[model samples]
Target: MKAIRIHEFGGPEVMQLEEVPKPLPAADEILLKVYATSVNPADYIIRQGGNDLLRPLLKLPMGLGLDASGIVEAIGADVKDFKPGNKVYGVPNFPGDGGYAEYLAAKATQFAPMPHNITFNEAGALPSCALIAWNAIVDLGHVQPGQRVLIHGAAGGVGNLAVQFAKAKGAYVIGTASAHNFDFLKELGADEVIDYNTQHFEELLHDIDLVFNASPVRDQSVRMKSAEVLKDGGIFVCSQLDSPFPAALLQVLAAKNAIGTMVGGGSISYTSSLHGTTALIEEGKVKAVVSKVYPLAEVAAAHRESEKKHVRGKLVLEVAKEN
Candidate 1:
């Protein structure tokens, strides 16, 4: 099998396309003939060794991808849920990343049967981003009907899905994106769209039931601004911890008897959690929006495009050509 591996951590140039041995499945795993895979920020973070805790666990010369959709070529002896010809989509576990290749093995629990309505490229784009949005909004945020939810970076992968998920829950969704994405966000069911580049979101929106920070803002002062728009006891969830909070903000929350919490790490347990995303896809409430596709040899270019931070949706790598 040919795979893209990064022997050392650095820029996009470090990713190398090389011929590697095909992976074999464990007793509870399945070997997939990969059709497509998507690139996520986690892939780059792992490649650049940005997260120290995950760095040590990363195998040297590791394969570079997290999400994939393909046909099951073989299944381990203990796997009964899937068969050799089943279509599936899943995220490979960290420290064993191998999606950017012709074939890779994943625990059966990490994948779900692909929906019949979508193409392989679209299926491949859903696992990581959709799972993150599902976990954040539906699980942790506890978004409900009639609620007002604000999503930052609404044009990005998770943002696009987050908007749809919130709307599907009957919430009035507000999204923050540049001017160019306003129409796109509206089409995705965003009730209100704010141009973050020109306007201060905190001043324009208030009493938000939930605020989801998907951008990479890490400053403490900057992060606390989201609290300004929250209603009393409202939830402020952020993917990045480096958000700024004012002392006055804490006082306000304390006076109102409200709580604030920050969360990171969308890594699924690869057990029961993956099933939830699968069900959502099958039900047609959620959809993967693939913005671009690159061939196996163009993995480096795909990464470069993702780094621009202007991509409207997910970017995928087609590991195998269609028949």
Candidate 2:
């Protein structure tokens, strides 16, 4: 099996596609012949070692990818929910050899049946991003219908899904993005879209019941501003799992009596989140937002694009064709 592995952290150029031994299922795992995977900010961030302190913690020569959609080639003795040839999609274990390979052997609990309404490339784009969005809006925020829910970076991978998920939950969804994406966010069910380029969101909106910061941009200013718009006793959710909640932002939330929480990639149940997203997709209430599809060999190119931080949706890597 060929996999993209980075022996040392640096640039997208560090990712190399090489012949590697195929992985086998563990006692509670499933071996999947991956049809596709998607590029995420985390992919490029991890490829470059995230930061100085984190760089030392990464094991060199690891595969890069968090999402996968494919057919089950085999299952472990302990995995009875799926059989050989089942179509599935989910997040593979992070900080390990990932889904950017011809095959993956991951814990069966990390997966769910792929949404029947989407293509392999689309399914590949959903798992990690959708899980993050679900965790933020559903689990942490506890958004309710008619609540004013604000989402930052509404045009990005997780942001777009967050908008849809919030909408499906009956919240009045508001999104912040560049002016060019205003229409796109609205199409994804945002009741209102603010252009972050020319307008400040805090100045325009108030009494927001929930604020979800899903943007990849690391500006603490967004966090402070987001804290301002929340209604008293509102919820503020952060998606930057690796970063701590700043004291200033915490103070802002405290002043408003708003709750502040951070969501991690693995903080929620993968099976349940994927199942919820699948239900939405199959019911036509949600859609996969794929920006581009790259051949698995062009992973380096995809990384370059993801590093730009301007991709509207996910950039997918085609690993194999569904037969």
- Which candidate has the top score in lDDT? 2
Candidate 2 on 169-263: residue-level lDDT in tens?
A: 99999998998898888888999998898988989999999999999988888899999999999999998877777899899999999999988
Over the full model, what C-alpha lDDT does candidate 2 score relative to the true structure?
0.90
Q: Kindly list the per-residue Cα lDDT of model 1 for residues 1-323, writing each as its tens digit.
A: 78888888888889888888888999999999999998887777777775755766877867878898999999999999999999988887655566888898888887888877788898888877777777778777889999999998889988898898898889999998999999888888899999988998888888889888776434455456777778888887676533445677677656655556554464544434356666666788767788889997888788888877778889989887656
Each model's C-alpha lDDT? 0.80, 0.90
Each prediction's TM-score versus the true structure: 0.91, 0.97
The TM-score that candidate 1 achieves is 0.91
**Best of the candidates, TM-score:** 2
How many clashing residue pairs, candidate 1?
8
Q: lDDT, candidate 2, residue 52?
A: 50
TM-score of 2: 0.97
* Lowest-sum lDDT 10-residue window in model 1: 264-273
